[model samples]
Target: MTTRHPNAGLERLHRETGWTLRQLAQEINRLGTERGTPVAYQKPSVHQWLNGQLPKESVRPLIIEAFSRKLLRPVTYGEAGFPEPAEESKNPPATVEGLMELGRQDMDPSRRSVLGAGLFSVALTVPGWQDVVGRMEAIKQNPKLRIGQAEVRAVLAMTERLSDLDDDFGGRYARPMAAAFLVNTVSPYLKAESSSETRNSMLSAAAFLCYLTGWMAVDEGAHGRAQQYYVRALELAGASGDHNTYCHVLRGMSVQAANLGHGAPAVRLANAAAEAAPESTPRMRAFMAGQQAHAYALAGERTNARTALREAERAVNQAESQLGTFGGFSSATLAYSTAEVRYALGDTLGSIQSLQDHFRLRDSTDMQRSKLIFSSLLAERQLQVGHLEEACATWNSVLDEYPAIHSGRIDEQMAKIASLLSSYQRNPIARQTSERSRELCLK
Candidate 1:
């Protein structure tokens, strides 16, 4: 076995710093709580390192860089991580050259050379993902071209490939890159008159892209900024009457708000998604219900939470109980996770049970990032309940997947873990989980 770092290189991240597993876990759990997530357990510093399980695919990079900051040196993809730029090296490749080249004057020759290679790889593969500069230019071009089916297909295909361009690159690649495509390639078309299909397509693409931008912001620890983007995306998505996207945007908002501690708002937003997206397919309906249930959990309405959760589970079951093309909303776990909102609401024991329920129903490996995120949270919950040895063993086992999970929110949690470690007297685990993380910074 590769004997992955249990969590990429995060397992050893704060090791040299001397923090304990319990302390780490406390800090990690505090992160979700601080963010307004219903979860309230503040895992100890030691648990930060010992917690088992890793982030799922959608959130691997986010988890990795968060802990990365504590290390004396940054870790990218392969060695330590996949690859990093000499300057802003860990940024996604497609946008690396432009993103890093803006201000880099000096860097190691060998590192620079390796970064150059990584950049090339990211660009050709993950071109759909890039930053949001020159956005107005897209509008200036042909607004008539927005979301042409041909273009949507091309960009989406590219996005799928870029999604796999490896963890050395960040998540901004997809969100910003797609946003640029919409603004530059598709937005002008909004000014044109066309079939409902074209308009819907354009709006769908733009809304999702905008959501990605906001999501990237959230991932990078800019919750307020992400909120703005999410709100805008929701409006745009609703404008096009694309309920799927509308629901997804609402879900995103709920995520940010829940983290910010606005349980009522989260619940309201989620409920709106469920109601507005009534015409949604089973998969989409389940997901919408799930988002709502998650909000209910945040609000501490266990009965309501369970009720909505059951509805979501019904949707997921109805979706999976069949065997046909679910048309872009076939993900069963989306709804199942919603049903388990109690976990995020800091119902660790509840979450563990819900997770088990979710695990039973979750049959898709396509969501590696989601699994990691939920799993990491559950492990922290276990640690908070006095499972110190279990926490350490957990971190030792499942943290290797950290490299692939991308989200900046994870960094905030890791910082909290580092803070907790500093309080330890002489615990090596705390030290290890609390070290300074490396970065592909512009300096």
Candidate 2:
């Protein structure tokens, strides 16, 4: 008879979770449902796995994610006594090739669900500027294939169009198109022979596109997939030696972490971004500081958060115009950031006031998708403050625009409307709003 050894690594992680076998199994099953692959695992199944029985291949990621969530850190396959997934390579591919592969996967509808199921890792290794600067892999030039400033300009223009689309609609419909563009059009441009200046411009443009794609993924609630795109953006920005874009991508990563409620990582990424661009313009300063304020608040650093908010206010005050602003950082954007910081710091009333200010400062050019998101947030806060009528009215406004947009984030917000108003169904407006929300969700 063969002796089967216990999985010491898995056993160690299980102990760290402080969960009973039943609890561990339940958590894994819960995560499976979240990933759209429901499973029914019991204590016996978990016990069997710990006692030298390997889990099915498909269940391994769920186990890893469950531990990562419970322990508030990433748990690798090896750390959990599982073999690495076959698709993961020990030797990372060159930047362009890796980007192509990622884009292709994103473009394929059949692969998207599986790709989106990737777990967001709190302990992801982010490469610093020094590590990736000017590190693009050498490519064999095809003498006939040459790109110049015009090609770079075209890419930038295309990206701008995509951004407008994302703003008007949502990322759910726009992201596939972006992935296709990255794979079919942008990838070739990256490999084409060009002058150093033109090449750098193309790289910077591509990095921005990647950042936008990641931003869209976040809107779709595909956080893990979003992080992958963000990392690629950072790598490309660093490779091009574009300090501004590199800092911008870092700030974006901070936003992702903050949205996911990973406060420490958010603060770290925000600080890194600000530190990298000490000599940035006033608008850029406001952009970075506002995010820092929100992150610090999320991390429970009230003093630092207040100081950063004040700095952001001053920087925005000093800026002459919003023309060519990085990420459209304006007074309105500052107001929104203020709202975020206030909410994170437990000032619900102050956050609501700030959000109102955000809407007031908006122009006709503001993205409809943003308007919907902010409106939903305002309504949720209104309900929190015991203003049932006001909240319903605000939510009604959101529902007015809800049908036209396709966003996972918006869908999540819509999903909350019914549950939030369910208790107040005796109130006519609340009941009406709940019914409407349910109707929309069904569609």
Candidate 3:
């Protein structure tokens, strides 16, 4: 028989944890339960893990959490004896090159492992974010082609176009086109730079497209890929001395973390954005404050959440007097943030009202998918509060709109509604909505 030795990585961590195998297993089970997974492993599972056997994929997160709790720091899958994840590039040239290559790899089906290799690592991305801002310097003049402002504007235009497509059709369709653009057009311009000023503009434009691509990844339900793209965007933004974009990207990271139910890291990233952009415009401050409020709400910090929400509203009011258009956060987005905070704080009626207000204020053409999602949230909250008939009416208003938007998030919301309605499936209203939801999902 071939002998299986103990896994050195597991053994080292186990020793550092200073716990017996049975104790470790008990802790893992407890951690899993806290995470809503109710694991029931004993000493045998820990022994098997120590004996060079990998646990189930779902168990990996639990293991990381258990160790993170014991070690009093974040623990990654690699550090906990799992396979190493693909590392993101740390510098501008490498990041640009990686983004170009990622675009190509994303297009090739045979290279799907490039997209699927690892889970998102907060430890890798978050700690490094603090060192990126204010470190921007002039780019070295690596003149290859005669690039100018027009070329940079072209990229920005394409980014805006793709953003529209994403708003309508979702990221699964836009991601490939965005990737191709980066690989073919943006990559050459990034390599074939111009004067320092032009290069900065070019880099900033590239970073924004990268941020868009990252947002698309999130839309398509690839959180790890999204994190890598956000990291690269941060690097490019820093290289361009665009601290506003840097803070914006950090806010994006917080949104991703919150979506993944990672509250603490979400709060950390949101707070970092607010602190890093002390001189940011009021509109930008409103955006950051909204993010902070969302993260605080997710973490169950009710006082902090309400405080941030008030700050967000005040910043938006302050922004009304500022010069130039506030392109990012509007009153509708603020309402969305308010809804999230209210829902988290157990104000279901308030959440539903806020969402309804947002829907009334938001132009559906601007964000069809988001509108659909908020509508779903409204319906779900209405159902939670025993307003079944109103919930059904809220759901019926968008039955036609559901079939057009190609978003994993939208799909998730529909599935959740279906699941929630399953209990009331015998009711005529619930039955009709359930049937329609099933049809939309199948389409």
Candidate 4:
């Protein structure tokens, strides 16, 4: 029933290993077991691969190892008939290659390699910042490809547009296009020769894209892929000596950790980000401190949460007074932090008030995802306080935006709201709203 094509590359590699198909399969299976994922890949499976069948992405790493051990040399995934992963290194060219590979894989929605390898190791999140930072390389005087200011400017422009799209439409709409641009356009520039200035600019641009890609991955519910992107982005940021972007990437990691309920680790990452930020920007300081506040709240450290919240507010006020530039540290940023702090302290009314302030301060043209999230939280809080009519009303606001955006986080929120409303199914308003929420989820 299967069409077979000659996989000459794989057949050639197997021949070089001096092992028959059976022996190779045995070695692969052993490696898989050692890695705690037992696989029974047999000789037939090896034959099938040689006949052009691709194994699961997770199995590719094990196969690479099997070839490495048998061949007595470092075997890349490509050498073992698998696609290359996003590679990282102190070397800029190598890092670019990794980013390109990531982009290439992401461009194909059907490819499960990156998405399926969702290995979120909370253990690996710690213990690399110092080494990574220390190993940051200086901009190369001579790059492989000749790059110029024009190319760099183009990449930056694309990044800005993609960022805006991400804010408005969520990651699902823009992530594939971003991935394509990174690989098809940006990677070539990174691979080309360039002057030191051009190289630094290019590295910074690539780093920004990587960070955005990771954030998009988070929105896609692919936490493992997001972690990989964050780590590589941090490396690129450090190598470019871009402290501001470096701190931002760290803050992203902290946010992801907090979302995963590893509150202590999240707080630690946020603290590190705050420590690493440029002193000239109070807005950055406030954002990092606010992240720490949110992490503390997640950890149920009421005192620490309040303390960090106060610090965040003070820094935000200072930033505003001094006219510091804003990125993610806009007015909505502070209000969101305040809401988290208040909710942690059991001040439901205060939390609601802060959330309303967030809505008032956030630009209407900004990301609809944020609006959906804030509205969902507001409705949940209102429902909790026995304000049934207001809760239903608040949820209706979310429905207004729900059909327009595609976000895993938003979908999860809608599902939660639907589940909560089930208890109120006897009420006509609750039943109607619950049905609408379910319809959105199905879509």
Candidate No. with top lDDT: 2
Give Cα-based local distance difference scores for all models.
0.49, 0.90, 0.79, 0.77
Candidate 3 per-residue lDDT, tens place, 221-330, comes to 76778887898889888877787778788888999888766677789899988888746677887988999999999888889999999999998887774346433787
Runs of candidate 3 with Cα error greater than 4 angstroms are 1-43, 50-62, 65-72, 76-93, 109-118, 127-130, 133-144, 321-323
lDDT of 1 by residue, 73-190 (tens): 3345443332333444454232212212211311222232222211001011110111221221112333444344676566456545544431234443344454454454444545
Model 4 Cα lDDT, one tens digit per residue, 21-77: 889999888866545467898888988888888787778777776665555455666
Clashes of each: 106, 0, 0, 7
TM-score per model over all chains: 0.57, 0.93, 0.83, 0.75
Lowest summed lDDT window (length 10), candidate 4: 134-143
Worst 10 residues of 3 by lDDT: 84-93
Candidate 1: give its CA RMSD in angstroms: 16.9
* Candidates arranged by TM-score, highest first: 2, 3, 4, 1
Write candidate 2's Cα lDDT for 1-443 as tens digits: 11189989999999998999999999888877766678999999999899878899889888987887778677899998888998764788788888898898889766767777766666778898898889888977667789999999999999999998999889987999999999999989998889999999999999999999999989888888898899899889988898888898889899988987878789989999999974678898899999999999998999999999999999999999998777678989999999999999999999999999999999998899999999999999999999999999999999998999989899999999999998999999999999999999999
* Candidate 4, pairs of clashing residues: 87-98, 143-193, 144-192, 144-193, 145-192, 145-193, 146-193
